[model samples]
Target: MTNEKRLPPLLKLALELGPLALFFVANAYADRFGFAEGQRIFFATALFIGATLVALAVSYALLRKLPIMPLVSGVVVVVFGGLTLFLQDETFIKLKPTIVNTMFGAILLGGLYFRKPLLEIVLDSVFDLTEEGWRKLTLRWALFFFTLAALNEIVWRTQSTDFWVSFKVFGIMPLTIAFALAQTPLLLRHEAKKAEEA
Candidate 1:
């Protein structure tokens, strides 16, 4: 993709986050519009599927390439969301986070087992870190993903559907952003060390 055609940060964030916001809104009003409980969830799942496709399309159109993270997420969303609507079981959708997070954690940690820091590939465009820094950051993220997977299982199994939906929409994103922000000092320190070596 040409630099000029690349999506700006704000627009990219919107593409990634808009579908989730739509899902939350759709679920919130599903009942007021008289949808039955099952149908409400089905409606929200359907909307999520459509919104994910739209977001991916917009990303490709503007950036000329699909982002790796969102592409994986979009695929899972369609698959699990389809199963949820097809089986009329909310369990499928609720299990999506657990599956996705577990997969990510495994991929990252497995890369470390092979002495490769896969996070460097994912975030290299945004961060410049020493080799040790990449290893540390990758380990931290792997643990964090595992924690999120466990939390998803607990929340979905114990909570009401609406509560789970709210947690998915409101809870996860903030936690991720906060976690990323908390690593800023580590990131800056590593970048400074790299600069000194250069």
Candidate 2:
């Protein structure tokens, strides 16, 4: 609520998604670029790392500050991605989502344990809600994050590299969007009235 203008939703989505899209594309065509069968993921990880940094830079350039969630995610991407490239291990990159989601889940739940709703801060305080509403919403998001972390673990452990990449791009994004849209009713129901305007 600092009166700073947020990025347009579509633009924000693009910035958030552009790296993933590029990662997918890079992985899909790594063979055409002559990377070995086992090296495709590594190649894609390099691109993903670069794209994430670029996206963060763009966000900072536009807003003069980075969003908390993306900045945290980007840091993990770079770290895990670097490990993947330097060590020639796909496990690090594959585990990145699981680690990130679990961290977010724990953070949210920990906040609630202390009677704080950290989601509001993470979301830049965009939504004004009653305390109960905030608690409920934060709890829902925490569980959702845990679910995503579990899903990522299952997929990455059991699926092929290509399949895991596809799921990360296709599966997770749609699920998140659906979940968010499904919260509209809760948000509307709990919206705080501007008593000061009376």
Candidate 3:
């Protein structure tokens, strides 16, 4: 995949994480900005929607294409975040993560069921792996996504909006990064080597 386009690491991080940071900050300061007691989540939802759209546009400009995962996640955020703001209910925004994570998990598992190894399609630029490696890695990611979905369900249903907002940015992000980094050995062990040029 020498020809695959790659975003520089820091730019990629900003494109992905900047929207979440804005969401967290907007929610935290909504009160100071004169939003009512129960309306701060709506304020955050609106910002999240806008920020996600901006991020996607920036990504498209830089890469000439949107990455699969973020593109899917951005669509879900816009839809659910719109519902949250429109219905004046925070439940929809809170459910966004559970829905997105579960959808990803199901898609990965479904791909494996058909022996497709779809993660390769999304990650080929980052890693070159054997078929077995792709299968193992996809299964692990599928399980991890399901775990994240369950965790989101538990936290949002049981915790306050402020707590959920904090957890989304501070807790879930860290867990995701840690889990992805932990896959380094598997990625290294199964990396595919290219033939030498004649």
Residue 36 in model 1: lDDT: 83
TM-score rank, highest first? 3, 2, 1
* TM-scores for all predictions: 0.93, 0.95, 0.95
How much is 97 displaced in model 3, in angstroms?
0.4
TM-score of candidate 2 against the unseen true structure? 0.95
1-198: candidate 2 lDDT, tens digit per residue = 456768988989899999999999999999999998899999999999998999999899998999889999999999999999999999999999999999999999999999999997766358887777889999999999999999999999999999999999999999999999999988877776743244
Residue 120, candidate 1: C-alpha displacement in angstroms: 0.9
* 143 Cα displacement, candidate 2 (Å): 0.3
lDDT of 3 by residue, 1-198 (tens): 758778899998998999999999999999999998798889988999999999999999988998889999999999999989888889999999999999999999999999998999988877888888999999999999999999999999999999999999999999999999999999877877731221
What lDDT would candidate 2 get against the real structure? 0.92
Candidate closest to the true structure, highest lDDT: 3
Tens-digit lDDT track of model 1 for 167-194: 9879999999999999988898778456
Clashing pairs for predicted structure model 2, backbone only: none
What candidate 2 gets wrong by more than 4 Å, as runs, is 194-198
Residue 33 local lDDT, model 1: 80
RMSD of 3: 2.2
